[model samples]
Target: MSAELAVVYAALILQDDQIEITSDKLQTLVKAAGIEVEPVWFSLYAKALAGQDLKALLLNVGAPGAGGAAAATGASGAAASTEAAVEEAVEEKEESDDDMGFGLFD
Candidate 1:
């Protein structure tokens, strides 16, 4: 695996075990797994995640908040209207085509 991916896996393992993410811990895990990772990657992830609740972050991934739900609802409404308009246009086209007195068997 790539160095960056190895580092990510190591961080996930540390988080999964409820261990604080630190450069040293990340390095230890990566080494134990026989995966090579850059020194900077471990520190980068550790510092970035410092003082954060990893579990909450993991659980809430891709979960939209109130405003996000509102936006999604608005988008759904717009998509429904657009779909209805397209269907109406298609129905009109089909009706007009049928009135043209044209048939394959003719």
Candidate 2:
């Protein structure tokens, strides 16, 4: 993994453990996992996340109401309507008699 991503993962682990996020903690986790990332990455991530509630923030990152089911239903409905429109267009094109100056017996 990239050094940057390693640092983020370490921070997330710290958050999951309910441990206060700090550079030392982040570095410790990263090193324990056998990953070698620059010290700067740990410090930056720790500082950025110091006063934030990672869990709450993560939990809020999605559609606000009715959750995944609503999103899935909307997507399926749109797909069905689009499929019907495409089928109608194809039928009309097939039924056209013009045939652009070409004929089956030509």
Give the candidate number with the greatest TM-score.
Answer: 1
Each model's TM-score?
0.56, 0.56
Q: In model 1, how large is the Cα lDDT of residue 1?
A: 91
lDDT of 1 by residue, 1-106 (tens): 9988888788788888888999999899889989877799889989988988777787777655654554677877857866898999999887777799764455
Question: What overall lDDT, based on C-alpha atoms, would model 1 receive against the true structure?
Answer: 0.82
Taking the tens digit of each residue's C-alpha lDDT, what string does model 2 give over 1-106?
9898888888788889899999999899899989998888888998899999898778877644545655676887857866898999987776674466654555
Per candidate, the number of residue pairs that clash is 0, 0
Q: Which window of 10 residues has the lowest lDDT sum in candidate 2?
A: 97-106
Question: Where does candidate 1 have its weakest 10-residue lDDT segment?
Answer: 62-71
Model 1 clash pairs are none
Which regions of candidate 1 are displaced past 4 Å?
A: 65-106
TM-score of 2: 0.56
Q: How close is each model in CA RMSD to the real structure?
A: 8.0, 8.2
